[model samples]
Target chain A: MFAKRHVISMREFSREEIDSVLDLAESLEPYARGGGCDALSGKILALLFFEPSTRTRLSFETAMMRLGGKTLSLGPTEGSAMAKGESLADTIRVIGAYADALVIRHPKEGSARLASQFSPVPVLNAGDGAGHHPTQTLLDLYTIRKESRLEDLRIALVGDLKYGRTVHSLAYALALYGADITLVSPQTLEMPDRIKADLAGKGTMVRETHALEDVLGEVDVLYITRIQKERFPDPYEYQKVAKSYRIGAESLAGARDRLIIMHPLPRVDEIAPEVDETRHAVYFRQSFYGVPVRMALLKMLIGDRLE
Target chain B: MNDGEMKLRVTPIGNGTVIDHIPAGQALNVLKILGIDRTTQATISLLMNVSSRRSGRKDIVKVEDRELKEEEVNKISLIAPGATINIIRDRRVVDKYTVDMPDLIVGVLRCPNPSCISNTNEPINSRFIVKSKNPVILRCVYCEQAIAENIADYLI
Candidate 1:
């Protein structure tokens, strides 16, 4: 049913669509765990990464391979036609001819949507610079559902709310499920006013705080993100808030027993290593869920079976 | 009679459009938006710093033989929300309507984001949903990037 549909923004999805993807991801767990599936035997998935990524790129490739689909990848701008000054539209139009679908990760905001406009096939946004990442939102939803109840839970999204595209997408998606959201970030890195207004329009309960400790015990899910050093135009500002909201074992002492810690990884010092052993730690498992979730998306988008 | 009481009325156009009540100092932006500066044939008159009871200071533009489209009026509202659009026919004002802020705008203004897909070589037209009217906040439909000030810089 999702054939040829571009997944550029989580804002475009309804609650039912989010649920369907989560349900499909749950069903495809075994298949993602390496159980055989040839739903896309001859399909070719093209991956275009204009920015550095580890889990997102790897999971998408793994998802395609697990679905018996082949992949063609263009990694880093240095070696690609981009290095030769090829336009994003030209690259997308050219690659759209060779692949059945495209997954693009660009450093520029809205580049994925731009790519999708030129691409003939469905274009899934891996991550866009300070913009929406629909697939990551899907996997995060799947992870949230798996770890804790998705509806009516307190979710505190901590660190770099201004620039974290993942948190931006997640906040919008969580609003759909009527989740009470507490945004934790430095004063300089608060969530954008428009996003807060959007959440308010949706009747989503949103509160902002600078300290993770203030809301750690109250939230069911502590969604953590690194303070992206590259997003800052000023190095001094980055250094000022680099370690402002860290989560260690000491910080988790007052947290709920069922509190699930989730992070879109390549984490810096925002999360301590000691927090990794706690029962609250599910970030790695959350990362593992990305494969099945992406496989579900690919299947829904390109596979023969709609259900 | 004193110059103030002399009633200096702008000469009426036989058939054209008049944009009135534009915020003072923004007539140039209105001209740029309507492409009046580039139009070589049309007879255009621009009145700046005119007195107005409603806004105190206003600007006006009269374009001969040109009736503005709905989209053009909406674009004008982005820069001058309280401006009025007047259609003149046979030297008489036929229809006059205040420009209302549009909910959605298409292909009039370029997105401020340098990396926005609309800025790229893609054939996509930039689209925005008006979020606020007084200050004129435009949120890009594709990128969700909000532009609040200096919107004239992004006018297409």
Candidate 2:
């Protein structure tokens, strides 16, 4: 059961476990389309976002509510009991007794792992600095299947591959599914070495490029991510590489008409607003998949019975 | 010479090597990898989970007979670089030296990155560029993460 497990890295999920979630995702897609099912009745999800989150938190809360479940939210470290010098171990130890499962997001890289060590309930990683975000990757796999009708389609992951934990997780999963991926990011933001080797060894055709426009036409999915301006230690360094690449309305003209453009959302001009109206833009649907994917995850984890 | 739980128990071997000061729990893994554990006639005294005076806990494997191979010695130096080796004859220490890095490491060290092609499902022996021996750096052919040394719980 996911309730007893701790998700610190994407590697924690074996190929078989990912398939189980994918099967659940396929079965639960109808409920996402508003089908009749109370899969999460009598369950409670605990949200402990130690960092600020606009989309991730909302998606989990909505998923729980849609499943006829209740949630207890504790947002950001500044205002929470964590600011008062409470350790994550203590925080989760107390919260675990109340909530059946924990959806945790913290800035520390391995905060999710540390929380699960003490908590009696299962721990789900929302975002843990630049470490790993397994939940988002699951939704991404669902989105790719729903949008492209295949998992092995060519994808060009653009912008901030270094610090973008979402892309890191997604790339590993894509490699596992035998997808051809071209990583288009600045040299400084190139895909980490370990990730590149993993993909290439599995015979996934991967290339590193500084320009997204040069490789734009060859991809079935154009995954765009912001520069993660918030993660920079120096503001000027952030300013320099902030807008190195952008997937605007003009950029999509040359793309395959059926090509899907995805972002984890809350974009800062990396994707233009006009692009949202195009048939290619699937960020909203990308966001929507979060609910069912998470619901399917929660169901498989803590089960249908909400504690 | 005395076989104590924590001390490096040196046996009266006719001729052989004795590895001392290994961090507890690492000796068996090293011995297994070196094929010493599979010896049929050789008497093997493997003290494990033993407490260390320096490390708070450690282990020592004392072999009664049979000397380790030169390549095996080099591999240990390359992998378990911190371990000390002693060549003994007639129950007397003849030569003693710490394991040093080998010039060319074929399939010795496993890259710390799980996603590295070397660590994939395929039966591939990972080749290392071996950038820096001091602070070990290995560039993966498949991935960019040049794993730093000391990342492994046990090098062997």
Candidate 3:
């Protein structure tokens, strides 16, 4: 049962738990498509965004609304008490008193976990600074399963592997399903050693390379992430790797027809506009899946069905 | 004097504790962990960089009329994983045991990350999971940031 549980990391979920969530999401797909459900009628969710996130924030709010639950939103911290030097724990403690569950996004790593320690209700991580985003991972998993089979598929995660928290959490979730993962990134933005070690420890097949062309034909899924300019300590370093890996339509010539391309949105140039017309492009549909996936998550966390 | 005959000796305490086999140059860190400074009333003897047969060089701390608490011993293990704690009673070693590194450490050290919640105005204690013992790698339970060096500076 997921009642009162804090979803801080994808690593915290077992294969069975992930399956349960996916199953719940599948069952709630019709309900998310304008059907009615009062599973969370009296429940109130708190949305605390210390950072700017349009899609994630909107999806979570929409998810709660679809479930007949109301939301209390605290937008960007600039106008909030946090900018006035309020602590995350203090904010969570105060908000936790009012809501049935809390969804938090912060610019600092571990902010979600830190809030969870003081929150009386379940805390869902929207995104943390270069840290885990469990809900995003959950939605990504749902998309992958819907588009392609989950097990034993060759998946290539391309772009800024070092700073993309989405790739980090997704990699861990894919590892749970025994997916063969090829991490494609510039040398400067390669996956961290700790993550590689963890994948190896889990007996997950992992391959690292700088070029996407090498694994294009073999992959069943191409998960792309933007090479963020903000995560760099040196602007010069960011400029060097900015255009290193671009996936245009021409680049997908050798790729499998069944290959599903996905990206956590707000993409700049990492994914080409022409790729949007290709059959492989499922990233747009992927964004829509966030609603039902998050609705399932919220329901499981608050409703008596999963209890 | 011959190398074997040049043993440095400190007067034994009537009743207290002896922490031996500490890695060389960590005696001060041990004192910091024990909250021992110039203002302390207890009689304390610290021997640093002393030659030892077990290890090439070691540090030791002897405190009079004070036995280390279990929590204090755990903290010392973070800095000196190989240290041996010996309880002295009536000038005799009554109990002796080497420190065992704990799997989880809570509220003992500050997280080095300035952005960590533990560093904020929030009322939360720092928590770390011991990832390695030999080099003393501590991964913050919240942020998953690994702290490998300058651990003494983070001690609470």
Candidate 4:
């Protein structure tokens, strides 16, 4: 169903399509772990990242490599033609000629959709500023499906909800799976009413709370996010608020043993390092799930030629 | 005629378009969408809050020498969904029809999100998917952000 289609937004995927990707990712986990596959032999994937990303870029590259496909990157923005004032459309058009599919991560919202319009090959949005990172959302779903069941599970999305693009897309996907969601954030960072309203329309049972500890005990999954200091006007206020949101061992005393903690990583003090040793920490494995999830996507979009 | 008589008598347009049954105060917005400003050479007349038998109160815009374009008419449908377009030639109504809101509104309205790629230097026109008709909700085809309220403010 994903053949040659642009993966720009989570809104584009229905429940069946999301389930299909997760199922495919489950099948490809063996190759993602150690084995090699020539599903996309000789295919070349292009990466154009206007913004800096470590895990996303690496996982995408690794996913392509594991599939017996080669990958090329535009490298740093300062060194690429983009530094010379080339538009994203021109760059996509030029690079699309050399690749089977294009993965773009830009700071501008809807940049991937614009690139798709100009690109000859399919376009996958790694991320666009405060927009969508469908691949991340997919991998996140894979992680949740792997560690814990999606249906009827209580998932609390903590930290920055208003500005955190990861949580925004993840929330919608979780709601689609019929997971009861609890939004834990500072009042300033509460999930937008529009998003909550949309979730409610989907028949999702949603709750909003300012304290993470309030819902940490009952939730099946604790999704923590780093409170971005840049989003706040006062640094002192950020430090104070950031401290209250930190998930440490002490904070998990009342948490259920089955409760798994997941975080989209490169985390800055949101999930305490000490908690990494706990049985609840699936975030490290969660980060690794990106490889297989992305592998499933790359194969679906461009693997037909090899067949 | 004095100011009082001028206010009482609304002039008819010759060889132009008459947009009647506008939602009362939206006549100015319709004019704005048609690019009728101080620089416009056409004789434009906007009658606001006129008593209407159908909708209680309505507005009308008469352009003496200009007819509205397709894109302009579509944008007018956003604010004045029930507005009727009357084509006037030689001071007589030649044709009349109600504006139909297209399923896809393209190049007519801007994406209100400042960070939207359409607002950037990309070589593309602004596109919105009409999600609702009665209230005129538009979802940006690119960003997927909904424009539910104050939609006319985003008209290009």
Using TM-score, give the best candidate's number: 3
lDDT of 2: 0.73
TM-score-based ranking: 3, 4, 1, 2
Write one digit per residue (lDDT tens) for candidate 4, span B19-84.
Answer: 999999999988877777899888888888887778988899988877777656867788888899
Top candidate on DockQ is 4
Model 1 TM-score, 2 decimals? 0.88
lDDT ranking, best first: 4, 3, 1, 2
lDDT of 3 by residue, A72-110 (tens): 999667888888888778888999999999999887778
For each model, chain A TM-score? 0.92, 0.89, 0.93, 0.97
lDDT for residue B147 in candidate 4, whole number 0-100: 92
Instruction: Give Cα-based local distance difference scores for all models.
Output: 0.85, 0.73, 0.86, 0.88
Give the per-residue lDDT digits (tens) of candidate 1, residues B1-156.
234642466766899899999999999999887666764588889888887888888898888898988677767888898888889999899998998877888887898888676787656778899888877788997678899998878888
DockQ of each: 0.48, 0.05, 0.66, 0.74
Over 4 Å off, model 4: A305-307, B1-14, B23-28, B35-59, B63-72, B89-94
TM-score of the second chain in candidate 2: 0.67
Residue B62, model 1: lDDT of: 84
The top-ranked prediction according to lDDT is: 4
lDDT of 3 by residue, B1-156 (tens): 245454435666889999999999999988887788999999998988888888989999999899887666867888888899999999899999999888888777888877666676667778899988877788998888889898878888
Clash count, one per candidate: 0, 14, 0, 0
Chain B TM-score for the candidates in order: 0.86, 0.67, 0.86, 0.85
